[model samples]
Target chain A: MAIIEIEGLAKSYRVYQKKEGLRASIRGLFRRQYRTVEAVRGIDLTVEQGEFVAFLGPNGAGKTTTLKLLSGVITPTAGEARVLGHLPWKRENAYRRRFALVMGQKNQLWWDLPAAESFRLHQQIYRIEPSRFERSRDELTSLLGVRHLLSQPVRELSLGERMKMELIAALLHSPDVLFLDEPTIGLDVIAQYNIQSFLRHYQELRKITILLTSHYMKDVAALCRRVVIIAAGRIIYNGSLSGIINRYGGQKVVSLQFIDGRIPADLARFGEVILEEPPRAKIRVDRRVVPEVLSGILAGYSVEDVSVEDPPLEAVIAEIFSRNGEPPEHQVGQIPELLKEE
Target chain B: MSEHPSYLRVLLTFARNSLVRDMTFRGNFLIDAFSSMSWVFMNLGFYVLIFEYTPMLGAGTGWGKYEFFVFLATTLIINSLVQTFFMTNADEFGELIRTGSLDFALLKPIDTQFLVSLNRIEWSSLGNFAVGLLLLAYALGKIDYSPGPAQLVLYPVYVLCGVAILYSLMIALAATSVWLGRNQTLYDFWFYITNFSRYPMEIYRGPFGTPLRRVFTFLIPVLIVVNVPARMLVRPLDPRAPEDFLLPIFAILATIGSLAASRWVFGRALLSYRSASS
Candidate 1:
């Protein structure tokens, strides 16, 4: 049932080193220097059928490259990748018809034409039956609430509306697998939530396997249960969202409210106090000792209310990315040291 | 869907999409059509004035006003067809690579070459194409020429052969964008090569012209694109005439060779393409 199976899939690019000034530019005409950049360094992953997985990374962390490899937009520099039992790079018509790749910065819709025209074009490209294509188009456009804008030119639509149209165009063919690379980028919060919910509904209704790369933690939290975190061209963490919080996430926030409106002087004994007021205080503590610290604080102080929560996902991910040379003790379970450092 | 759509149907969809896109800006479409047609008219007027002072082109090359105009019209037709179908797409191919839109193109089920080559159609070029046909008719009338069965039959075949050669050349040039990253020089090279095919091949028969003629005739084979089609019409096929079978033979060979060469270059370029990152 593994819809996607990738083993050591990698992509490397040879980039030219261009110096400044006119002289260097002129000299480049005769000879140039190049360095190989390993964009995606030997990644292995698998996603079962109908699973919605989030691929998270900072800028230039190879999230997009891995998506391209799976979508067959670019061939792997080394190793193999299979989606629905098809080698992506082969790019057989059969494989292409069953999947769609949508990029946030790049548009697949024609700028001057209406989204309706693009939908019809996709129908032909994927050879979707007329009745079935119409049904899928109607369902997707209605779900995305973009039916009213179908006749307008794509350039005229707002960023969010245009993205909805793009989603409709991509789904008109009823693809079996969807590879979305930052589809919600640049949209406002409401727009992002709309897209997130729509994706969740579509995945549930169609049961299609999806792999999405996003910088927004809200997108992952709202739509995907499984999260794969890549840093420096390698997957440093791959597990559930809460698992990341438990593994690499060392700290938690504990807020307390005293009934007598008095601060505890010995609160520092329990954890590092981040904020303090007359009636309330916020402390940061290791997640492992959160229970003991909570019990001690409640037992010592006259507290009226209390809460325990993990740190924000963005902070946790940032810590993982910045811990490039740090000790491996923060890693959960076991990721070979070599894979962790790559 | 039961089976993949036929290529012809997909091509029609591309054409329809392009047409809808063109229609979106009616004013721009008109301006583009009118301006391009005016440029062709100015070129025709300049050539008409040049023929007024000269009895024949290139001193006994037998290219008189009517015959040279026929050659010019043939060049116009081939150039218009290429510009209409392929030039803009080839020119913007670099932008596609730069912006990563080529990723969507590669993800499609269709042949990448077919999709990229015919993705956009410049409907404005139809004005030039129509003018080319009128010019061809006018030149044929001036020469008092009536085509025989063979001339009428072979003319369109050679024209298609010419288009195939030009398409091959342009595709090969554009495919280099994959390796060069952004090849603005492709337009320069395309212009320089196609410019060579605009005139009659007989003009390049002298001492200095011989080498240029050989290079364009055999190596690039652009000389035959316009010359063969126009010649087959002006001078009907005569078995007694020297090189009488040249058009039939060279047209086939050039078409096949250019197409094969372009395919190889495109395949190799795809191998070297480092697609743009998100």
Candidate 2:
């Protein structure tokens, strides 16, 4: 069953465009210029139950706006979306009680009070039964390894610890659907790994539907199997993580280690030499001709080891975003010509 | 299925959390309490000095020294309750909008207005409330006229109505922050508007004052907040004056209308909320 269904969902904002300089500022007082920003153009998407999907996009590509629309924080300008069988923008209490939204940049916990106090307040607001609330709170705190920090004031906790507490607060109600926007942003590598590990474990345990938007490729690579890439307010790709690499990443990188530990000056003849050293070298070759290139290299050089692998996912994703100008909408199950050199 | 939490339970939780937050900053809390009490005492002394020369607040106003003190006490009670429960929240509404923290408030499974209005209680402002009660008792004893049981029962009820009126106005003004981006002048505007309610309606009469009284009583309806309640307690309604009988009815209507209007404004503002980019 699909837990979220969005069709032609769009949101636009009218922003006042203030000109630079004193004279423009004075003119703005009388006649201000405004422009319509189409933050989320008409787009369609669906997520199945218990799926961990990554909503990927560049800055201002409508990732956070779409999340806001789905969470009922902001209404859309056009189209419709249903999450958990409820119209998100209607903001019904029943719908709100069933889902939770966590923004990494925002703090929901009381700044001066302990996280326990905020959790207790959430229990009251969500009307969770005391026993159930206690069980959920204890389990979440233990799972996040922040039980010791529960009594300390939120402001006193480290950023990573505070984020863990925020997650616990969000999950205490046992929401069926969770929307996460940049949850791993600005965290250290270890902190990111901790959060990613916890999310993966918890999702596996509960089988709850989650739509996470994150800039960290490591987070996407670790937790989400499915990915949706949006640019210019339109989704240009949506499929498996490997599928994105396979479709847009048409070249494979071949690394070779020479037994002689001597560099071949003419190695560039085979393909683009990405890296060259005395003992090792790497070359980028078209995927279809990788075998030919590898055979040619082996025939000339004293190669001890050779490996062929797809380009890094991060590189492929960056290429896609760089070419996302006026992106052609991508429909599910239909491959489109994307990332072609203009 | 989980039951919906009682609103009272949520309010109590907010109050508890607020108290803990205030206790975290003990020095600031103590200073705020002291300053609030000092302001109230200063205002009381100023009024006492004025009453030494004139027996009544205004000519033919029927508000003598003790009656006017009751009016002052009523103002303090209503204003203190508003400040304690809502002043800080209303002031912070613009900040929440600017910082996008209001998103959390809207996400909760409770009424947004209730959460925004009662999330913080300024324990310091309760000092004025205590002082108001003491002043009311002392003033009533000094006056020769005694209030009946009906008058006593209506006083507190009307006081609540007064608080509701002011809260509605404040919230409505705060909601405009959604469009304005920042409403820094909300406190100043509230002070200028509520300043009128601090005085007796009897004083707003004659050539220059009559128009102002009509405007405040009928249009803004702030005059009825303190005037109706104070009059019902200290000054009995005149049997011959039809306007006196109509004042209580108008007070109830004003409370309901202000609340409904503010609720509508808040709802509309929520729709316009851009929810600053995260």
Candidate 3:
């Protein structure tokens, strides 16, 4: 049932090194220098059929490069990737008809024409039967709620509407595997919610495999149950969304409401003080020492109420990305200090 | 699914989409068509002025007013076909690489070269094509040469060969965009090479021009593109002139050579494409 299988996959780019001054530019014209940048460094992963997996990474973390490799847009520098039992980079027509890649920064739709025309073009490109094309086209348009806007030129549509139309155009062939790269990048809150809900609804109806890369944590949190985090061109961690909180999420926020106005000056010994108020104080405690810290705070002061919760999902994921290449011991006191800087 | 569509059907769909895209900006489309026609007319007028001073294109060459007009029309026909079908697509190819839209193109279930080469059609470029046909008719009448069946059949064949050569050249130039990151100057280079093919090949027989003429004729085969086609129609091969007999044979070789070379270059470029992933 694993539709996508990637093993020891890697991609590197040779980037020319040009100095700042005009003299360097002139010299570069004569003799150029290049440095090889490993964009994706041997990532191993698998996705089961109908699984919606979030590929999480900070900027320049090879998330998009991995997606490109799987989508057959670019060839890998090393190893192999098989999507639905087909070597993706071979780019066979049979394989292409079964998958779709939608990138947020670039548009596949023709700008000067209506979305309807682009949908028809996709029908021909994929060679979808007329009846099936019409059914999927109508279904996607209705699901995205852009039936009215389909007749208008794509350039005239709002960003959200355009993204929705782009989604509709991509899905017109009803591809079995979908790769979405930052699909909701620049949309407003409501637009983002609409897209998220639509993707969730569409996946349930189609039972298709999806691999999504997004900077927006809300997108990952809303649609994907499984999360794969990459940093510095490698997969740093891969597990369930909450598994992130349990693994790299070493800290739990313990907020206390004191009965008395007296606050302890030695609060730093219990945990890192995140917020200080007269009766209420929020502290970040190591999850492993939460019980001890809570008991110590209770034994020291008159605590009225206490709530212990995991830090925000974004905070935990950010911590995972920030702790990428450091030693384990160095990560112990890293997240809080990094959060403080933020 | 009922039946798979043919690649021809897919190309037609692309053409239709491009037509709709062009029609969306009616005013711009009209202006582009009008401006392109103006350029063609200006070139035709320039040639008319040149011929007024010189009875023949060259001292000993048989390229007089009517023959040179046919040569010019042949140039327009080949150039128009290349412009209308491939020029806009080639120009936009760099943007495709820069913006990473080539990713979507590669994802499609079709030949990448076929898709990239014909994705956009500048229908306005056909204005010059129409004028070229008109000039061909007028020149044929002026020359008072009634073409036989073989001559008529071979004329369109050579024009198609000329177009194939031009497309090969343009595609090869556009493919460089993958490595260069930007190839906006492709049209400038295209103009430089194609400007030679417009006039009679004999115009380049002087000391300096002779070597360039040989290079364009035997090496590049662009001179044969217009000259052979126009010669077959205007002047039937006298058994005495062996070059006229060799023209058809050379056209076949050039067409095959250019197509194969361009295909090899395109494949190599596609292999090297990084898809703007940095």
Candidate 4:
């Protein structure tokens, strides 16, 4: 069943345009100027139950805005969205109880109190049964390996530990759907890995739907099977993670090893030369011409070994984000040249 | 599978958590308590000096020194309750909006107003509340009149109504923070408005004072907060004047109206809340 359904959802904000200097500031007191920023411009999306979907976009591309709309933190200016069969902006208690939102840059826990106090407060707010609350709390704490830090003040804990506690506070109610906005942002490599591992394991165990927005490709690659790329307030691409590579990743890198241990001079005709070592060489060619390029390289040179592989996911994602301002039609046609430039 | 928590239980939890938080920084808590109590004592001393010269607040006003002290106690009681429960929460509401912590609050499955209004209890302000009760008892003892059963029962009830009126005003001002982004003037606005409520409505008479009295009593309705309750305890309502008889009824209606208006304003403000970007 589809757990979330969003159609033509849009949100616009009126931002004041403040000019520099005291003169402008004085004039602003009498008449302030504002412009409408279309943060989320009419996008349609859906997610089935138990699907872990990655919501990827550059900064201010409406990734967080869409999450806010779905979570009912802010209302959309146009269109409709329903999460778990409830209109999110209506902010029904039932719907709010069934879902949770976690933002990496913001905290929900009491800063001066221990995480345990916050957990208890959540229990009261969610009205979880005593046994169920205890079970979920214990299970989540143990799973995240932060049981020892429960009694410590939240401010006293390290950033990673604090985030772990935040995750626990969010999950104590056993929400069926989760919205994560950059949950691993600002964490060290090990901390990020630990969080990713916990999320993957938890999602698998519970079979809950999750929509995660992240700037980190590792987070997207590690946890999400399906990817939803949003750019400039629109859903630019929505499909499987591998499908992104198939569509935008138009070129493949070909690494060749010469048997004679000599340099090849004419290898640039096949494709753009990426690495030109004496014994080995690597070049990037369009996927469609890979066979011809390989055959030509093999025919011309004394090649002992050769391999072809797709470009890195991070590079492909970066290319997509870099072209966020352009129309979709222009993006694909320009990718080859952009990749060559890279 | 969703069981909404009892509001009372949630309030208790919020109170308990706030107490724990306050206790975590015991020095800060003690300093806050001491400072609050000291302010109330200084105010009380100022009133004492004024009463030494004046036999009554005004000619034919019925607010003698003891009666005025009762009025001051009533103001203290109401203000202390509002401060202890709602003041800090209302003030922090703006900070929450500025920092985007309000997103977490909105995501909760409880009434936003209840959660936001009662989340943090300023236990330090309760010291003033204790002093207010003591002052009320001392003033009542000094007065030559004993209260009837109805006056005694209506006293606490009207005191609550006074607190509700002040809370409604404060919350409504705090809600404007959503649109204003940072409502640093909330405390100033509250102080200016409630300063009128601290004095008995009898002092507002003649051309200049009467207009101000009418505006605060009818429009803002702040004047009735302490006046109605304090009058019920100490000053006898004039049976000849129909207005005096209707004053208590007007106070009840004002409390309800203020609460409803504040709730509507808060709801409208929430609609305009642009959650600060993450």
Candidate 5:
């Protein structure tokens, strides 16, 4: 059975639309107007035990809302969701013991206490055995490399260091499922990598089900093979990472900065000019015309630096956002054309 | 394993943590301790001034000015003890709910009320308890009567009952966070309760005082905890129903209902908790 089973799960909040003014404020006390924000429209998904999944979406796309619903932090307006055969909204202590949610912007560690003290409180809360608690604490502290920072108050630690301590505090109970909303957000590249590698190693060793929502594409790309994309309170895309790329990302970008040539003046015939300066710059022709565009740009200018890479993820998502019915094609070069037309 | 932690364990842990957290700011602790001790002496001022114009409490009530001081002091004791522990950081729940911090608490495997209420420790209330005890001893010496072992036993019981009633009242007040939005004035509700409970109940004992008396007799139970304990220090124990213990006991029961209502309101509020953000 799936560790997490969400079927047509939906959530809506009666959000207040405040009218600003002294008179309006008093009037609002008697007659308040509220609009329902359908943050999570019906979303149906199932995660088999131990599946590492990425939940991807833009701001207000309901990724955090969905995670909140699954974690039982808030109520679902409609439908059903079950984790470990328990409704999250019921929020039983037993159910809570089996799961953990770590939000990057919010912290669980007590600011004025040492990280270890917070861990001890969590241990009591979870009723973890003393030996088991120590073992887990030592292992996580060492893994996150925050072992040395255990005695210092959480407020004294750097953001990166505090984040590591929070991880150890969160995982001490050894929950079956991990819910992370922007877990690696705002961390430096090295810190981000450290967190990512620890998550991967732990998941492989423990086979704990992991669900992550992050702005960093690399976190999803590096850790999750399956992706669930939400937009406008609905699941717009749910499939493999390759499926998202293949569906939205098309036309490889071939950017070359020629050392001594102006691309727009010299290489207009070769392909679309993306940027031109002391050297030339251009978006490559489609893959079918890769050889032609490459040879043409080389023939047309003195190219000193060049890089060929996939179109950026945000553009593909933009295309996804704007497109309806059929997914957009691999018209990667269409972006430069779309830009030129605009 | 026990369902909840043992009471001794809970007290020791809470007290230890309260001391440590307060000791970190040594200057603040000293200032707070000074203010709390001075409040007891200030409370006696009202008694001394009132009795200068009158000999006793009304006509038949023979309680002297020092005895009145004892009553006020004990009331303060009940209040500060309850406030010492029951005064929760959860009073900030409306903001926490708005900002998504409550989710961090909710996701933990613990009772949300217990966790939020006990998360922070305030040490200044201990000074109030100490000062109030000193005043009670001095007043007992000034008065003709002395409390026996039963009264000593009854003291802690009444205090516990008082603490329970106060906690329930505060929980009901704080639970309004869900519906009232961010600025739920828990202190306002507390002040209203304290106004009635702090005064001696005999001051308003009559047919017309039914609804008014019920405010402490049953409504919030502030009268039972403060009055019964102070009454113990004065006069011999009556044979049939001594020192109006029924009201305090009833207050404890009412508090149980209050806690249940709080949890229900809190659960409902969580449904609408937007997790406040900038």
Candidate 6:
């Protein structure tokens, strides 16, 4: 079920240009020209019920802006957004009751108060009946392993613990759709994995829809199979995360190991000498060419071991981001073993 | 599951947590409390010295020592309380709008104002209230004034109304943050208005004093809060009550209007908002 629908969604922000010197500051006070920045360009998207979609982008790439528009924190300058058939920006009480948004850079928790107090306040805000709130509160606290954190004030909690409590508070109302903007940011590897696992389980149990925007590829890799990549405020790619990998940069890395140093020419004939360490060398090949390259490398040299891998998502994303629309294949020769993997 | 705190319990917990958090700055709290006490004594020293010059200004509407000090102490107490509780996020509210930090409060399904206002409780300011009451009692003892029942009954109402009027005016002034992008100087504006409000308007040029008196009485209700009650304590009740006794009704209406306007401006600002993405 496609519970969330967005069509031709666009948002623009007004920014005043300032001159470099003190003169401009003085002049701006009297006379100023403002420009409209298209934060989220025309975007059309549909999210199915229970779908965990990663909305990925760089800074100012409109990822957070899109979430804000979707969550009703800010209104879009143009287009329409309906969450479960309710206009988000209109902020109808019913619509607000149905969705939750959590931003990593900002906290919703009362900084000085214990998480438990915040939870009870949330219950009153949502007008939750006591029994249901208790059940949900207990379920989230135990699941997040934050039961012990209930009595301690939020300011005393560690960053990981606070982020956990943030999630619990956001979910206390059991919102049907969750919009998370970089929720795993600044968490350690273990915390990230735990949160990701918990989200997956929580989503499955409640069948809630989730749309998350994160700069962390691991967050996307672990949680979202489908991704929507927005850059410069436009949706450049949308499909499976692997599809974006393939579309942007689909070559694979082939690393070769030997007992010691190796000649460049010996391995050069099979594939590009992308990396050269003491006894190890790396070559990249298209997935289509992996078999032939592997065989040729095996036939030509005394190879210790070989491994093929797709490039890190960050590297691939950086390449795509810096290109301003240039295809990744042109840079593949320079970006060693960088498989725009699907 | 059954052990979740009740709603009242939650608010108390929130206030307690704020107290605990402020306790970490215990040194600062002591310094602040001492600073407040010192300020009151200094102001009282002048009030005492005024007796050396003469008994009273004796001009019409000129308050004697008791009425004057009581009014001054009452306004200071109300001002400190508002600054402590209601204006906790006076500085942060602008940043909240600028950075979209307010979005979290909006999402909470709670009254955004209540959450933002109570988010930080300045526990040290309770000292100011204690000292304020002590001064009021001292003045009352000197004047041989005793408020039988009704006059005392209206004291809380006046003080609370004063705080509400002050809160609304601050909100209206802070609304400029939505457009100006900053309001660091707004507290000075609020403080100045309160300064003008504390002393009765009778000691002014007619041109200035009339408008000031009208503004405090009808529009903002600053005069009605402490001055009216303090006057009621010193002066006998008339068969016909002064027009200022009804000032709270007007202030309540204006507060509602100003709060609505602030919310409207906030809504408009949200459209132009670009969260600190740069």
Which segments of model 3 are wrong by more than 4 Å? A261-269, A299-301, A326-338, B1-5, B236-240
Q: Individual DockQ of the candidates?
A: 0.73, 0.76, 0.62, 0.77, 0.41, 0.26
Superposed by TM-score, candidate 3 places the C-alpha of residue B277 at a distance from the truth, in angstroms, of 4.4
Better of 4 and 6 by DockQ: 4
Output the lDDT of residue A143, model 1.
89
Model 6 chain B worst lDDT run, 10 consecutive residues:
B1-10
- CAPRI band for model 2: medium
Per-residue alpha-carbon lDDT of model 5 for B37-112, expressed as tens digits? 7876676776788889997786655556777777877787888877777775657655676566888877866677
- The model with the greater TM-score, 2 or 6, is 2
Docking category of candidate 4? medium
The alpha-carbon lDDT assigned to residue A167 of candidate 2 equals: 92
TM per candidate comes to 0.95, 0.97, 0.95, 0.97, 0.88, 0.85
Task: Candidate 6: give the clashing pairs.
Answer: A249-A340, A250-A340, A251-A339, A260-A279
lDDT of each residue in A147-186, candidate 3, tens digit only = 8888999999999999999898788888899999999998
Ranking by DockQ: 4, 2, 1, 3, 5, 6
lDDT of 4 by residue, A1-342 (tens): 999999999999999999999999999999999999999999999899999999998899999999999988899999999899999989889899999999999999999889999999899999988899999999999988999988999999999999999999999988999999999999999999999999999999999999999989899999999999898999999899998888888899998999999868877888889887879888988899999998888788888898999898888888888878466777665544435424
lDDT of 1 by residue, B1-278 (tens): 54566778888888888888888788999999999999998999999899889978888567788988888889999888988998898888777876667888888887888888889989889888899899999989988667789888888888888988999998888888887777888779988998899988778877899999999989999999999989878762233256646656977898999999988997777666667768
The reply for model 6, stretches above 4 Å from the true place, is A112-114, A127-138, A250-271, A276-282, A285-315, A325-342, B1-13, B23-27, B137-150, B214-221, B236-274
Residue B124's C-alpha lDDT in candidate 1? 89
The residue-by-residue lDDT of candidate 3 on B1-278, one tens digit each, is 42344778777887788778778788888999899899989988998999889988777677788878887888889888888999998888777877677888898888888889899888888889999999999998898667899988989999999999888888888888888888888889888888888777667877999999989987887788788888888772334288777778988899999989889988888778888752
> Residue A271, candidate 6: how far off, in angstroms?
5.1
How would you encode candidate 2's per-residue C-alpha lDDT over B205-252 as one tens digit per residue? 789999999999888889999999899988733442577778999999
Over A174-230, each residue of candidate 1 has an lDDT whose tens digit, in order, gives 889999989999999999999999999999999999999998889999889999888
Cα miss at A297, model 2 (Å)? 1.0
lDDT of 2 by residue, A1-342 (tens): 999999999999999999999999999999989999999999899999999999998899999999999999999999999999999878889999999999999999999999999999999999998999999999998888999999999999999999999999999999999999998788999989999999999999999999999999999999999999999899888899999877787788888999999879998887778887769888877787887898888888789999998887777888778777455344323323333221
| lDDT per residue as tens, model 6, A45-138 | 9989899999877788888888888877777888988899988876666777778998888887777667887787677667778899999999
